[model samples]
Target chain A: MDSLTDKIRTLCTGLLKDGKVDMIVGFKKGTIPMSSCPCVARTPEQAKELIWDSNCTLNLANYLTNRKEKIGVVAKGCDSRNIVNHIIENKVTRENLYIIGVPCDGMVDKRKIRALFNDDITLFSEENNKLFVETASEKKELDKQDFLKNNCTTCIHRNPVIYDELAADPVEEQKIENRFADVIKIENMSSDDKWNYFNDLIKDCIRCYACRNACPLCYCPTCFVDESNPQWVGKGQDINDVRTFHLLRAYHCAGRCTDCGACEEACPMDIHVRAFTRKLVKDSCEIFDWEPGLDPNKRPALDTFNPDDPDGFIK
Target chain B: MKVIKIDKQNWTGGIDKSRENYQIFGPVKDKEHFVFKKLNLKEYPDMENALSVLSPKSILFPQSEKILAASLDESQDDHHIMKRVATDYSPRAVIGIMPCDAKAVQLVKLNFDTDDYRDPYWCDAYEATTFVGLAVNKPSIYDFTLSMGSGPFAEEGLDVLLVDCKDHFLAKVLSEKGDAFLKASGFTSEADADKSAKLINEIKNQAEKAIDAEKVKTEKLKEKSLLELHGASFWEDLSFSCINCGTCTFVCPTCWCFDIQDETKGKKAVRFRNWDSCMSPLFTLHASSHNPRAEKVQRVRQRFMHKLKYFVDKYDQGTMCVGCGRCVVHCPVNIDIREICNTMNSYEAEQA
Candidate 1:
């Protein structure tokens, strides 16, 4: 890991100095102990600040789109797949991007990791493949594998599938269980119960549109709901509007969602938005044997119509 | 043609007298904002003050209309199908249409008339309606000067063009529909040659000046390639402040994306279309659970690119965005489209 970090620093410094990139967006040491935040490095000196560790869990590829200058960004296994998807969608030009692919041995859920320590853990240090957390009291040592995020448990990709530079020895891929137990649990409920459950969950929505904003796939110029000439959705708070919003969102993401959990993370109401998304993902896999952000060459399922595709809902 | 004068105060009386004969619709105050609604001549006496918050397109393409309805039956050893019903379009008058909206109705007409799957519902409604376009002596708060080409009024498709000439409105019949409507009212007369010339000159001058201003600005913005602007630092800066509430698209006059779904009961189903926004993560979500655009910045970029690039490429005309500034006023974070255009202009200048 030390050798990998050094190589990354050298590559980033050269890229910045040679004017190959305007900025290097990567994980940097956070002010809080043991955390890493996304940092933009414009100069070679700033490149030294960049770091990669178990704490660097953010999907940094989200920032690469809509940038003017050539940019170098760090990508983990899942994050690299997202970049591939972006390239396929023409959201980011592959030629202009400098992707540093890093093999991740799963990231730790910070909230869960923090719960193991005192509330006032002001600082943290990583050395010799061990995490030393400093709270108000004495320091505590913990193994890196104990606090892996839930998404990592079933993550099939551990090596960067696409990259200009490799940071670490590529890790072998793991087999993942395709069963969406959570969605199936909800699906097992009676139709009336499911309706009530969805209604109760969606009724709390203030329509802030945070989930939409945080998501990476929604890229339309004139959203249908916003059209005024033939007004689609009314401008007021109605149950129909709320239902339409959620149902439409789910339908839109039917095949494209990457399961980054960013929407759920960004949601203020703590609604289990992922439950519906996971259901869609599971259904897509079951019906089409397709997973998004995995293969960039594959055409989107909805955009490509198939006569053989099941249409039980359609008349 | 002789010009006739009616006291501004008595215009309402004229409308009231005509109310018994025509189904009059115009802008009416709805709580805080104004919307086009059915006007009772006694209630909505003045039509010259404010612009209608809602476009008059609803008269042609209603908010919700049944495109198709079907029923399934198994007892007869065959599936039974039922056809959707059409709407009745009796004679009606849509009063106080701004120029942009008038143009929009015409644009929609082109699509309905030429498309393979023609919208019979709107076509029938448009054939039966008479448009009374009022000149915009005052600019709307939601004006899209650059995209709209003309400021408020474009004198092309209106049946009757009403100019606010202080004491009396100077009315000109542009089409046969206007002629028939005026004759039926018995209150309108042909304008004198001098008055007609003056009104034409005024409208031409206003439209030309607005178009000229837009030409200069749009040309400057067009100098930069939208593809190059994709990765600009300015997008990050412009988008970081955006709350992604989607109010900007909702308030836009030209935005027209929709999603269709079916609601079913007892083997019967009604398919309905609802508005969908690109700002939401699900807009491009394929059934395979892969979204190519997975970030807010990409979504934001797509919005501007469609307005400035894709729309122009698809529609030979500028997608008819008569710069109604509804997006500016309605956006929760005040992410103004004008600012985005200006930013694009400046960014191009900087690059150059």
Candidate 2:
């Protein structure tokens, strides 16, 4: 972990100092445990602050939106995919971005770590693919694979789809047949059961829009929630409004979502927000046989619909 | 001060007693974290857990609350007109609210119950609930409430302060509202006032000592001038990772910014107020499409300045923040306010 961080900082410094990029975007050690913060460096001195680790879970592609400057960005597999999505959407130019990609080991879920201890985790350090946690008076070690974030464990893409520079050798992708097991559980339920299921899931959402704002693809000038001409939803905490917000927001990402878990990561409420988006990812694969951001030339599933598109659901 | 002792076994009975007269709210275990929710007859609040994901400010000011409702039918007499949503303003008690969150209610009150126009939704809710604060025996690492002018046991906005004593609760009743609550709960056991006071002091001193060890800068912020601090030029770097999300604002106890909208759901047209954050670009966008604080850096600076400087200067009181540490913990990017506050406080004006 330490060596990777050093390597990233060295690369970022060279990028900034050589004027190859106006800025370098990466992660730095966070004040809290088990996480890192996104950092942008315009100077070589600032570039030295960058680090890399399992905690670099936030997708850096969110920062590339509408960026005007030529810059370098540190990207993981999901982040690189979203960057391609941005390039295809004209939110940013391919030439302006210098993507330094890293093969990923899933991010550690700090919330789950806290749950394991059931107390304040005072000191936490990761080494040898295991977690060493210290509470007020006790310390324990746990296997890292057991604690990998739910999103990462199910991820099929552990290597970036595109990169200007590879920080390290690519990691072998996971082979999992049951990636959509949770989504299937909801799908198997009766129609009323599904409605009730989603309602209960999003009942606690405060409508703060963290899930919407954190996604790289949600770059609307005026969000539908904020529209006044014909308000599609109310600004109340009613279950109907909250449910509508989550459903509509997920529908917007039907074809473009990469299942990066950035939306779920940003949710303060720890809502299984992915439950809403993951269903869409499954349908896109089953129906359109299309995966997003694999090629720069290919558009998203919804962006260009074929005349031979299946009409199974329409009838 | 009225000091009362209640046996742990009878605590639920007392809470049940109050349920008949008032709607009872307390922190209940949600899936992974805790949230302030209305209690059932047998449900218990876990005061020993980490802070609620969202602050107890939601007790008085919900994320979205309907203020007015009316009919949209053209044949109706009062079409396109709004009327007050009849709310139950009956007395309620929120148990297990943290001391810092209680203080935050007091801080946010400056905006809602001011000398000018009053926000009736907030004011009515504030008036209806009695705040019961639980003392923090072990403060979280993110907590800097000591420097923020509120402490774990600080008694600013609370009616009663509770100390968890393993087998029982030591309740210090500060106001008549608290006394009335206790009486209604059928808690008649009174403790020796001096001895109870001495015990509370020992616990408070020990807790405060631990908090004082991790000093988070606050005092020097008041001494800095507005212009120099605003132009300090480090704000962009500080807010670099900000996704401009509403997590920080919605979880905040002191962030009271809200937007009012009217929506017609079926036949009912309702006006609702939902929490809004200054970090969002839409928060400042004008109808003319010209926004003064359009830039992310400017919006970010406004959030801190309003919490740490503008509110201080305008109210002639302290900073607007109660420092419950929700934003520091929940910000996806980990934008620590402690670092920002220290920078603003210590920034010096260039040689004139």
Candidate 3:
């Protein structure tokens, strides 16, 4: 797995030196422990700073939106999927992208790891399947498999659907047994319980739009929250307004979301914001027999109407 | 000024008693993080933790609040007119607030409260509450409060400052509001003022010394000019990783920008204000669609300049930041403000 880092830098520097792409977008060492930051390298020298690790949780597809310069981006399974979504949606030109793909294992959940260390993980290092953590007083090693983020644990794709270059050999896709169990739980609840469940889920929202900004699908020039002619949602701290914003934002990505966990990772509040988007993913899977971002030629479930589809709900 | 001591067991009793007269806002453990909640009767504040995910600023300047409301009913004479919303401005107490967060509220008050104009909602909320702060005895690596003029034990904005002595809390009452709050809670046992002062100074010195060891100083920032610092070439590299999300501003104790809008539900209209961030492109967008800060760099530059330069020039007090390190810890990309502050502070004017 460490060999992938060398391959990434080699590919990035080659592109930059040969003028194959204007910039190489990848991950760099983060100032915070157990995290990696997104980086864009214009010079070959800067490409050496790039790192490849499980901590590269942010989707590189987020950086590809409407970009003018030809870019070489490092993508995992989820990121490559989102790139396909972007190309199909006409958000970006596929010709301009040089996708360097990585077969992913999973990303760590910082919250879960922190709890394991009693919330004092200040220093960290990773080995084969063990994570070494330290506090001011002591150090400990724990199994990394126990701390994978919820989205990554259920990921069906471990290899990129589309890519210009492969940094390493592809890994096998997972057989997720309970992918829709959470959404189904909420679906079975009574109307009042479901309403209360979702309301409490988003009770801590500060309306910072981290969830929206982190998503590759949310590329609108003017979001509904900023519309003035007929403001769809109020900007105040009202719980109703907060709930309205989340529900509407989730619906906008009904068939398009890749379930990449970028929104959940970017959220400072640690909200399970995917609780709303995953339901859409389940609907697309069960009703339309569709998986988004797998094939660009196929339209999303919501984008086109089928004559054979049930017509009673259309009206 | 007076000093009092309250037993650890009686902390809940104090809060339980205070609920008789004052509404209580305090930090409570919420799943993986802590949040400031309006506690129900007999509920005790979560004093076990030193900091919360969101600061206590929402007590005075909530993320969302109603300022005015209107009705469309034809029978009323004031129909079609907006009227001030009925709000409870009665005495309230926010316990378990950090001293840095309290100082941030005071810094934000300079914007909401002024000689020429006043924000009625914030001002009213400010006047109606008593701030009870908890001093940080052991500071984190991210804490630079000592370098920013507000130490872990600074009492500039707090009415009653509590120093945890493990078994009991040494309460230092600094203002009349502190006296009223203490009285309501039935905390009548007074401690020796001189003894309490000596103990507080010991913790204060140790925490400040720890911060000084980090050496993330800000004294040089005051000497730099806005134009020279703004033109520095490092800003592009510094802001490169930024996703332009509102995580930094929303978690900050001092950031106070807001956007106001009206919402109508069944002919009843409400005017409310929600938190806004300068990091967003929409923050500076004009009605003509001509945005001056259209680029992400401009927006990023505005946040640091406002905290480091604009606020310093406008207030003549200090930088708007209290250095609580919420933004430093919670930034998705690990864009530390301490590094940016150092860059701006030490930036030399280019040779002409």
**TM-scores, all models, native as reference:** 0.52, 0.96, 0.95
Local accuracy of candidate 3 as per-residue lDDT tens digits, A1-54 = 468889999999999999999998899988778788898899999999998887
Q: lDDT per prediction? A: 0.67, 0.86, 0.86
Output the number of the DockQ-best candidate. 2
> What pairs collide in candidate 3?
A237-B64
List model 2 lDDT by residue over A1-315, tens digit each: 777888888898998888999998889888887778998889999888898887898889989776778979999999999988888888888899999989888888887888877556778787879889998767989888988889899999889999999898898999998988989999899999998888878877877788998899888987888775555667678887788888898999998899998888898998889998999999999889988877888977888879999987785
Interface root-mean-square deviation, candidate 3: 1.6
What is the model-wide C-alpha lDDT for candidate 3? 0.86
Q: Give the TM-score of chain B in candidate 2.
A: 0.97
lDDT string for model 3 (B287-336, tens) is: 89889999888888889999988888778888888988889878888788
**1 against 3, candidate with superior TM-score:** 3
Per-residue lDDT of model 2, residues B232-341, tens digit only: 77887887788888888888989998888777657888888888889877788778878898888898899999988888788867778777888988998888888888
Candidate 2: stretches off by over 4 Å: A305-308, B72-81, B265-268, B350-352
User: By DockQ, highest first, what's the ranking?
Assistant: 2, 3, 1
Once superposed on the true structure, which residue ranges of model 3 sit more than 4 Å away at CA?
A305-315, B212-215, B265-267, B349-352
Q: What is the DockQ for all candidates, taken in turn?
A: 0.07, 0.73, 0.63
Q: Say which docking band candidate 1 falls in.
A: incorrect
Please list, in the order the candidates appear, how each scores on TM-score for chain B only. 0.82, 0.97, 0.97
